[model samples]
Target: MALDVGMFEGHRVNRAAAERRCATLTTRRSVKKAHQAAWLVNAVRCVDLTTLAGDDTEGRVKRLCAKARKPLASHIEAGLGLSAGELTVGAVCVYPTMVPHAVKALEGSNIPVASVATGFPAGLMPLHLRLEEIRWAVAQGAAEIDIVINRELALTRNWQGLHDEIAAMREACGDAHMKAILATGELETLNNVYSASMVAMQAGADFIKTSTGKESVNATLPVSLTMLRALRDYGMATGHRIGFKPAGGMKQAKEALAWQILMKEELGRDWLNPDLFRFGASSMLGDIERQLEHYVTGRYADSSRHALA
Candidate 1:
């Protein structure tokens, strides 16, 4: 697949309509009691439990990996009739320099170590350096590389430049899966989001991410809807299924339910798995674990009780 301006050049997203649809999405659909617990469990499996901070340390990454390996508390898993080692997060995401620690920590757990590379959050570094960073992370045993796109390229409508850059990064990723962060908040419009998404997928992005978790605005329902539309369109045209990740600013169990509902409705149940969708959040897991505990015990646990994630 190659870049095709015709696919998204003239595309327009109706913000109000998207907002309206999202507004009613939660209110109209209700998964109560057991069904709600099931959805929350599924969300846990698809979460990319992340830790990306300026002061990140190897100990912190290992702790996060330990959580990923055993996400649900023993009592909660037993209450739900889930076996030991049955449930785990999709991956443990961390800074590139911490990939080795994560890899060692998650060994034999079947959980992939995902590292954010390519000048993550800003992506302002030189192109060559960015590609090399991706390569280095893969060599460090990262199974997944989350690379941020240059927002300047998207803002200026340089789709060709954007596609070439992402394509090169994808090449540098070798066999590791690449999630291209669109940084949609800085792109200024849903039109740019759609176009950038198309270009990223055309360039062989395994997934199109909504943000770097560093933008002022990140992972809104309207923006996710726009990206999902592009993903669907790309799949229809190229017969390739691409994944989606919405990172940042999502910190509640309800938000996880909302996004999962959106995914099921828009892309069907097929997209509800870890391979097709992921929530990139660190604190959100605490909320989800609390909710699961409440479901099992009919009482909410303190947030600190599930703070390991």
Candidate 2:
């Protein structure tokens, strides 16, 4: 009698062969679980100084820092808290002079202030003035600084100039978290965005942000996907983990979740934490709240009250 080779050759097989394949599958699953465990351990061990230092501050500064670190839901609850256990959201991003307003809005909540600097929308200012703007922002309690990269230099292939400007701005940021905006719309190409993303990371950007929100063209999925990939590659090559923020055009809960999904898919679960991801928007928080409310209440919110300004 001839052996039935057909059944044994593929996924379908005799009992004995299937048993052997089951053993292989079990071993592979065990190995994968072990690898994931190791990755999780390393991630837990990695310390984010920004987050750690945030815990030590005091007064309004401490509140803002904590609020900045809180998830979007927590921020909204603070505003609507009818009880004593709830605290307001603490961190906000605003124009240079608007730092005080953000600070006041977040008062008693202990949120830190963030300000956009260096002729933010255009970034067409002298180096000294930009540095001064950063200093002034920090002096006014801006714990986070978002600076726009000069698009002309980036577009003209002036990598070194762009790098130096970012480095200078980083220094001027002092201890504040420095988010370098690529202004993706102006870059106008995936290749440019990728190259600029690498330049920003290599030049000392604590976070490589997608856009300034002032431009007509704002952050998009393709541009964000490209930037995240560049950061992941850069991290692998240099062993320095970089953060990503897709700012502008993020207006709805679905949009925020889409960016979150993109980050998780592109950068892995290790980057899913707040330390590695942020959504830069003046209007997203309210949408996130409304969605959360709808999830719980099964109805859209009567009014959307969350606004950065």
Candidate 3:
């Protein structure tokens, strides 16, 4: 699909309405006991188990890969009647240089390695260099590439410029899937968020991500609702579905349930899978693991028991 300003231009989002809708998504819909456990497990499958810290090391990435491989402990899996190695996160996300470590660590498993490229977190580098970064990550065996869009372009409403740059990055990704980070917090208005999401999808983004996990505000429900509206509109007109990922500041199993509920209600069960949704989280898994342990034994385990993730 080519860039089409007609799709999102002049689009307006009412913040109050969006906030009200997000509010009901949690209070009105509730999953308890077994149903809650099931949704949490689904959330585990959609997690992009990530380690993007500046102090990231090969050892750390491998450990994260190990967690991704066996997200649920054997005791918990047995209690749930799940087989060994039956559960795994959607992908292992790391810095570009750490992709090889994750790729090797996750070998012989179905999980894919994801790398944050295109000068991630800031994306302030020159365009040519950013394109090269994508190529380099793909060569390093990253099956998925997360690239941040230039906030300046979106802020100034330079749709053509934004589209061209993302298209170039997509070309550089080659065979790898691309998740375009909209950095919604910096985009100011919900209108800007919708327009940017539309532009990213039009430029061939396989997923429209909410943030890079670095912004002061990241992955708020109101902003995510706006992006999903754009995603739904795009799907309606073009019949091509795109994924959604909410990254940063999510650290509870209940938060996982909330987002999954949002996806199921707004986009149906189709978006409930890894192909259409992802949680770019690192610590959130710890809480989920703890909750599952509690569900199995009727006692909450110490946070340290599930702290590895």
Candidate 4:
């Protein structure tokens, strides 16, 4: 797929309307009691149980995999009317070096190991090195690759270059799904956000992600709405459904419900699952667990009960 420059032609986002919609999304929806707990469990299912840090270790990655396997205690899922094996995170996301650790730990459970590649967060490295990083991670058993787009291309208005780079990354992924991180915080404009989204999807990204979890600001509702609108337009134009992920700054179970409600409203209920949406977080799981505990026992579960920090 090539860049269709006209895809964004005449595209104009009404800043006020988008903001109003986001406000309504924030205020109108409320998931309570059993529904809130169910949505929290679904949030657990959609989480990418992540650990991306300067000092991530095999021990840390394996523990993350363990968390993904049984995001809640056996009794919690049983209380929620789910089988012990039914509750799990969407995937385990980690740095490429720890893919094997994640893969080994998550073996036989069918949980995909997602590795962040292509000079993640900054993406300032040379193209060959970045492409090689994707190949290396895939060869290491990464079932999915979360790639950072070169912001310079989008910033410089080099849509073709941006499309080409992402297309190459998508190719290198082979059988693995590719999540193109637009880093909305860095794109600087919702127009750029929507246009870059069109370009990423045009270039074959299986999922268009909002951030890399390393930005000063990340995954705000307005930016997400802009991206989801692009997804809606792209899907309607091509008859292909792409996934959306709101990464970073989403640390509450209530926040999870808000994103889910946005997805349902904008893209319909189909995208509420792990296949189409994911929360890229390591700490949010703890809050989601606490909320679930509150639902199950009528009291907040101490943070220490959940292994994640």
> Candidate 2, residues 1-309: lDDT per residue as tens digits?
111222112221133532353334323422223343232222212211121122323344334334344433443344333234233232466677766655665555544566788888789999899999999989987888889999998888677788888888888888999989899999866667877878887778899988887779898776776677678777877788988877776666556545555666667887766567666753455555565555444566654443322
lDDT of 2 at 78: 43
Clashing pairs in 1: none
Instruction: Give the Å error, residue 217, model 3.
Output: 0.4
Candidates' C-alpha lDDT: 0.93, 0.63, 0.93, 0.90
lDDT of 4 at 237: 94
Which residue ranges in model 3 land beyond 4 Å of their true spot?
none
Shift of residue 218 alpha carbon in model 1, Å: 0.7
Which pairs clash inside model 2?
Answer: 63-110, 63-111, 64-90, 64-110, 64-111, 64-112, 65-112, 67-90, 90-111
* Candidate achieving higher lDDT, 2 or 4: 4
The all-Cα superposition gives candidate 4 an RMSD in Å to the true structure of 1.1
Tens digits of lDDT, candidate 4, 258-288: 8988898889988998899999987889888
> Of the pair 1 and 2, which is ahead by TM-score?
1
Summed backbone clashes in each candidate are 0, 9, 0, 0
Model 2 lDDT on a 0 to 1 scale:
0.63
Q: What would the per-residue lDDT of candidate 3 be over residues 213-280, giving only the tens digit for each residue? A: 99999998999989999999999999999999999899999999989988888899999999999999
Clashing pairs in 4: none
Candidate 1 off by > 4 Å: none
